[model samples]
Target: MHIGVPRESDPGQRLVAATPQTVEKLVALGYDVVVETGAGADASIPDDGYVAAGATIGDTDAVWGCDVVVKVDAPTVSEVARMHADATIVARMSPDDDPALVEAMRAAGVIALNLNSVPRISRAQALDVLSTMSNVSGYRGIIEAAEAYAGMFGGQVTAAGSTPPARVFVIGAGVAGLAALGAAGSLGATVRAYDVRSDVAEQIESMGATYVRVDAAAQESADGYASELSDEQEAATQRVYAAESAAADVVVTTALIRGKAPITITAEMVAAMRPGSVIVDLAASGGGNCELTVPGEKIVTENGVTIIGYTDLPGRMPKHTSQLYGTNIVNLMKLLTPGKDGQVVLDLDDVVQRGITVTRAGELLWPPPPVQVSVAPPAPASAPAPAEPAPAVEQKARKGTGVLVAGALTALLVVAAVAFSTASFASHLTVFALAVVVGFYVVTGVTHSLHTPLMAQTNAISGIILVGSLLQIGSTDTVVTVLAVVAATFASINIFGGFSVASRMLAMFRKEA
Candidate 1:
């Protein structure tokens, strides 16, 4: 098999399909590697590096003629038209719900393996192109903000006085938002983040960023992605959003609702922002989070604020991004490839194959799962079958059994108390024995009378009293008295603690009933 890495044709896509390292891996796997001239240049891999990795460096025409054409973006129609009928084109084709691109891949007779369509399974982590790019896109979002904001992130001490640190407000506590927060916070900026998932607030706080939350109807999908908010909820969040956005020197918005364009950032909200503030819209790829954002362009607000809508943040850091994404691509391909003995094989029965294989055997083989329909519940059963009541005689017997056990435990405790009172450490031991007996009685009483708390308080009071008695006992026997006091305190605490535990158990029984 032959694999080709082509130069990206997408306007802002700076990523290369395969780096030299990945080319080497493909070569080891029994595939001839061809890379278009300057294919990995944007990603910091020179043409010489491909040659050193045993890959042939060729022009675009030669590269496109291979058995497989790998790319960072979907190939243009013209490019597809040029491809060999049976060739496979591997790339990221998101919102694959689009029929035109789906039909084109079929007509071209080139198998399209969309990297973005991979699932978030544990075994697929290395093959998750979406997660790979997202990790980089997340990091770059903050670096872009730092560049756009004129002021330094960290505080400075000048001849005049000290200046406070810059403030960063990040919306959406997803991978991108958290990365932005981390970058800003590392530079000593006061970072605050908000998300529709209130459950993630603890994570945000753990990362040293303050979590900002507003009261609104929260909706989360089964996959844990934020669901689109209703109009009322959106309106309710605006004022709080505006206040936080207005105060921050930098704001990074990463909220995205899967297939939809990001929720619009209203003009009123933009107006509230201070002049010179910087906003990096990670959601710009899908419309934008800001009202005035132009995808892949930076727009200056009427108030002189900079709203950056650059969509391909991960592309800007292609070296590491390609390394991460290529590993994902290789892992995915390996899963699809067949092998024998010490070799790899594709299991068609695997959920991964069914989920990501968009088309097979010249047909659209992939479709989203059917939506679950709610069925009207059956009416309550008329005259529900009567449950057999527990026998009254058995209930009485169990009560008697409990009482018998309590009495045996009490008798054992009494014997121990007698032994304790006559022991050499009598004075201190007597108090502890009395306290233990009282504690057991209170716990076994079947009800939490005033004696429960009273027993606990008395246990503590006995400890203090023991110490006072020891002090009066003086030096000749002071050490002995102190030892007795320590023993008494330990025994009393254990006794009272057991009673408290019993009270808790009884509460559970009541609640269950």
Candidate 2:
């Protein structure tokens, strides 16, 4: 088996598909590795490194003519033309977003395995190129924002005066959002995050940042991407963004709706933000989260707010990006490698294979056809049989049994109510404790993804509890008054906290400027 590593043809692409370290692994796996000259120069991997790792350094034609070709970007029409019929090509080709790529590969009789299509399941994590790049993008997004903003992220105290910490607002609580949150928090910025998926609130909170809660229902696709919001939801979200952005010194948007343009940050919102603030839109490749963002360009609004919209952030850190991406490719290659023969095998029954294989054996397999199964034919219809009547004695017995059960239940309820009404304070407390325990168990059963929304909803309900606590605060007994005051204080915090979080979450989705 021969595996070729070609230089990325895209002008903006700096990372290569395989590093020398991975090339060595491929060699050890019984494959002859061929790398295009200067293939890894952008990533700092020299041709000598490839040679030392047991790979042949070859020209473009020799490299692309190998049995299997690996690349960073989708193959160009010309590159596809160079591929031998039935030869395999692997890369991060977003086929669904560009069906022409699939068609071109099929026409060229090339097998196309797209790295972006790798599944998000735990078993495929090592092969997840999207996740690997997203982590880099998220971390880089913060660095870019920090560089653009003039103010310091962390608070400082000097003999002259004290500087308050910068406020960072992050939209989206996915991998990128979390990375941004971590980066910002580490720099001493007071970070707040919002996501359409309410379940990520706990994750945000766990990262030492507040999770903004919103009133919107949780929306997530089966693949874990956020679904697009309706017009009404967008409007509500904009209102929240207006409030939060006004107070934010730095805002990073990582929201993405798969296969569609991102929900944009409105021009009005930019105008409302404090001057000198910076906005980093990581979704710039998908047309940006900010209306003012120009993909791959940085622009400053007349009001002094800087909007940085560099689309390929991961590419900026090519060395590490190439290493991570190369590892992912190696993992994927292991899955596709056939036993003994060392040939690339396409197995539709394998989850990883089915996901990444866009074209197999010269056939375009993306948007895979629905599986068809044979069903047995129904038997010919026959006349209905007469229904059997219940015996009078049995019917009477059933009625009697129902009455007896109802009477027993009623008696048990009456006895329990009477005992509770006459119960001592200790007994009442015991019952309350039991109820709390039951509630704890029930709440624990809820999925982690719902924690954010659940927290928001609980905060709303806590308002009613606050009112009850306030009423009790008027009692004459000193101890009772003290307890009531504490309860009321806690309730007030819960109510206000929930609304604050919800408002922040809604702000991320806000469509207005």
Candidate 3:
């Protein structure tokens, strides 16, 4: 079988259907791969690399000759007219009431697989083009917001003064919203997020951001998308929005309504916001959520709020986005024909393939795609296995014994070193080092028995600071009068304090189980 890849026609669409690695995989599977000249150039896959991977470079005419045609975007009518009668085509063909494209596929007699129609299931994750694109869109949305907002994100407290962190509000909790939350949080801002689905509130909070709740958002759509709020709900929502808007330094809106113009944020809402605030509308391409939002433009309201409504946010970082989208296409291609050795295999019984296939057997499939079914993964086992206590207990016992022995040896060494020094501070240094060894051993033993990270860090900090001070001041000689103070300051922190910490930790095993 032969597979073909043509250069995508969509403007700013840099992703190629097949990468050099995918071509290599196809060749290993026994299929001949052909790519249009310069098809993957934007993705950094050189022509020589594709050739090395056993793929042949060809003109558009040569690509249209293959049994299977792959692409990143929906094929145009002219491109579809060039396909062979029985060729299989796979790409992100949106089936949202596009009767014209559906009819065109029917006329061409092509087996059209809409990759965007993948079910939201564990098995479909590897082949999900929407999620792949959403991930890129989400990441890019934050970066653009950060660039537009001219203030720093994180709070800084120094001797001079402290600057309060920027307050970031994200108006969706889907993939893009979550990514925005993380990116904003990493910049040290006080981030808050909201979603129509209450289930994701905990997830937002877990990422160290506050979850803003609005009672009016309970009306979610059947497909789990947020529905447009009723007039009454919208009014109430604006009240809450006014408060948050006044406080927020940056607001990123990622709300969407599948197959419809997005819900609008009124001019009144923008006017309510503080001056110099930034609002990034992620659903700008599908009509924006903000009245001030102009598709592909950044507009500042009369009062001073910046509303950014740029379409194709993912295309801003084309290299990484292409890599991800290309990988998704490769995965689906491999799954559909694992045994074809690069040949075409039309398996109609497969659930995913059947669901997304728009045309097959010289007829257009009825009820054009987005077929849903419960395809969730099996729930993980709730409980973990009971762990064996013997090994853990024995390890603790051994550690206790070592600690006791090391502590005893350290105590003896400290006494001997101080006795020979015969300085006025020798006694004080010996006493302090011994005390540190004892304290460290006790804290470590307690923490080891408990197995708590917080406790361990607490004890570790205590030991380092205490023993360090003692080591620097403990040792001195009788003849060295003036230099004795310097020696005490340096040597006490280095020798006594350092050794005491080591000795105490090792002394844990010296105790009986």
**Best TM-score among the predictions, by candidate number:** 2
lDDT by residue for model 2 (1-513), tens: 899999888877999988888988887667899999999999888999999999999999998899899888888878888999989999888787777768889988888888877766678889988888889999999999889999999999999999999999998888888999999999999999888888778789878898877787456665656777887777777777888888999999988777445655789889998899999998888889898898999999999999999988999999989988999988877887766345777788987778787887677789643322213333558857659989999999999999999999998976777676754444444544454555455555644443576794575455545654565577677887898799778877876676687688779868667
In model 2, the runs with Cα more than 4 Å from the true position are 96-100, 338-341, 369-513
Residue 473: error of model 1 in Å? 26
Runs of candidate 1 exceeding 4 Å displacement? 95-98, 158-160, 338-347, 368-513
Q: Give candidate 2's total backbone clashes.
A: 13
The C-alpha stretches of model 3 lying farther than 4 A from their native spots are 158-160, 216-224, 227-236, 369-513
Name every residue pair that clashes in candidate 1.
339-344
lDDT (10s digit) by residue, model 3, range 7-96 = 988757777887787787777777788999999887777889889989999999899888888888898888889988888888888766
The weakest ten consecutive residues by lDDT in model 3 span: 446-455
**Best lDDT goes to which candidate?**
2
Residues 1-513 of candidate 1 have per-residue lDDT tens digits of 778888898756778878878877777777788899888877888999999998998888888888788888877777877778767778887535567777777777766677766655566667777667666877898888888888889998999999889999988887778888988888989999988878788778878899987788466664436777877778776766788888989988888886455654677778888998998888888888888888999989889889999987887888888877777767766775655121334355776655565654366665634222213334588968779988999989999999999999998987787675755555555655665565555444533232456665655555454444444345367776677667557756765675787688668758343
> Each model's TM-score, in the order given?
0.70, 0.71, 0.69
Evaluate model 2: give its lDDT.
0.82
TM-score of 2: 0.71
23: Cα error in model 1, Å: 2.1
